[model samples]
Target chain A: MTLYASSKAALRVYSESLAQELSSQFPGIRVIIVEPSGFRTEQNVLGYPMQIPRNPDPAYDSVREKSMQLYTSLDGRQRGDPEKAVELIVDIVRREGKSVERLGGGRAESPIYVPLGREANNDLEAKCTKMIQVVQKWKDVTDNLDHDDTNSVDLTRWGALRFFFLGSLHAYRAFQDRIRALASAGF
Target chain B: MTLYASSKAALRVYSESLAQELSSQFPGIRVIIVEPSGFRTEQNVLGYPMQIPRNPDPAYDSVREKSMQLYTSLDGRQRGDPEKAVELIVDIVRREGKSVERLGGGRAESPIYVPLGREANNDLEAKCTKMIQVVQKWKDVTDNLDHDDTNSVDLTRWGALRFFFLGSLHAYRAFQDRIRALASAGF
Candidate 1:
């Protein structure tokens, strides 16, 4: 089974659990979870309008403007080269439709500093590569499972859901971290 | 931009609003949505279990068991072929990497209907498919701004939250429909 999710945060949660769940059930089936980083897609730009909750007070106008600027500046630049993203997606889909897990990211990651292309570097391509790696791991683990009895596999009642929720929690934590960083900067 | 979603239901919502919002921003970019059918993957059999709102009760045991039996019957049957399902997903992901929508299904319109390749025709696949189609149509109409342009695109003041609330209403309506069906089934 192959799945594509647009939001890195949302899709990661959905895909990971799905990959894990499928791995346990259909032992030999191929499952791929593709997580494409920010793309210049409508979802990133225009899927949902930035609905401010209230009229910004004059005091907060500058902050609002800055936030809007940060968002709008990403207009067509936040995603990787659209063409390459398409190519990578096609390649993954065409593969034997095996159990695979891949993530598409635009560029390299730097722990201490942001990459040059920032979030837009070959995001989809990188995600695709990671998905491939995940699928390979899944394949390897299950291939060895053949020696073990399927009866021994105690399937979780909702393992997939738990994995998905965990991913969401992780993303939430990441968001919290970013907020903390921004707050610290102000302080 | 191409987009891929895990379910047609998800794609429908993703594409409709996303395309509607960004259509004006990026004229040349193409938005693609893919609706893939159900497949048997590790996750399909088991997903993160939903956090039940309340404690489980013995009274609901029979109901849950019936639901489970209905779901298990459609594993490898008419709902969808896993290989085909993955192939469709990969194709859409590649072709619509910029923007993609996809979905999976198991249950049919009626929970009672059971096909031969039972493994593929589960309840989740069916609902997932229906959900995709419904959401697609729902979002398409909601995003249409021809009726009142003035109220359509404005997101400067509390508009985002207002729209979110409105969307939630629609979702609630959909959920109600599902509940009504279950009620009629004597659940």
Candidate 2:
């Protein structure tokens, strides 16, 4: 299964854990997590404050309006082409051929110690490498055992709520930092 | 997000619809659905047949013995290597990167008809393709620009009773077919 995440700082961890669980239960399957840079969409815009609604803050209004204008001017070509987006998905299907993953979005790179859009993709790659490595080690230990024998759902296990919350929060904080960086960068 | 379906047939549909929902809401993200062949695992062989004790089928004892033998034999090396599986998954991650619909399994040249495994891998794949193609076409027409969409769910969509009767029956039939295939192949 392959999932495309727009912001690594946004929904990356959520998608990753889900991928792992699916993989464990189903044999001969693969989960693909893709982190793309920001894209201009109906719900989200890069370097822009959401226009839906918020507390009245005159200080932030000017910048918000400017961001909205920039997004609107881009039409549908802000981050990447929408048609290209669809094609990319189809291409993956063609390439993978038989085993396919469900899709979603998150960031492609790190959010730590860098301004918005400045985090290197390699760092995110590193994170993914570590994740898979740890999963490998764990699988080695449990591969021979009956998963259902110990099927008691343990929240402290790798596939638990606490892990999810911690992981998601870390990603969320990283995203917040990125948004702050963008705001500071005069979005 | 990508989902590795427990039963490649039904879960494939679930993952497909999920991919569409995520893609429409979060454009840059991709969803991959991986349909898997059976692995030699406890989950694959446990509690296979349920006899109500007074059942009068002459073939029941033979089937029960066969199920027990399959379970006992599938301890270690006979199982698929988790590392190899992970590598395949990571390979897709690298190739598709951020696109959705990546399918990974052991095979060459994407064929409309893949060969059947004793465990019914080909059947699962065929079923998955049907479900995805159908839903994909449906989405093209009913993107549902207005009301709240009711397509995807985090868990089973069917209620408890219906799920037990229909879903469980479907899974059981698949399991029985697998057993028959494996037995005939002299496994």
lDDT of 2 at A67: 39
TM accuracy, model 1: 0.26
Docking class of 2: incorrect
Residues B115-182, model 1: lDDT tens digits: 11212122224423433443333232222212221322222232332133222222223334544655
TM-score (chain A only) for the predictions, listed in order: 0.38, 0.40
Per-prediction TM-score to the true structure, in the order listed: 0.26, 0.26
Worst 10 residues of 2 chain A by lDDT: A111-120
User: Least lDDT summed over 10 consecutive residues: which range in candidate 1 chain A?
Assistant: A108-117
Clashes found in each candidate (C-alpha, N, C closer than 3 A) = 84, 40
Q: For residues A43-99, write the lDDT of model 2, one tens digit per residue.
A: 332223434244396654654565355434433333322233333433443443211
DockQ metric for all predictions? 0.02, 0.02
* Candidate 2 error regions (>4 Å): A1-187, B1-8, B40-59, B77-79, B96-121, B124-187
Candidate 1's C-alpha runs over 4 A off are A1-11, A28-31, A41-44, A47-60, A96-187, B1-187
TM-scores computed on chain B for all candidates: 0.36, 0.40
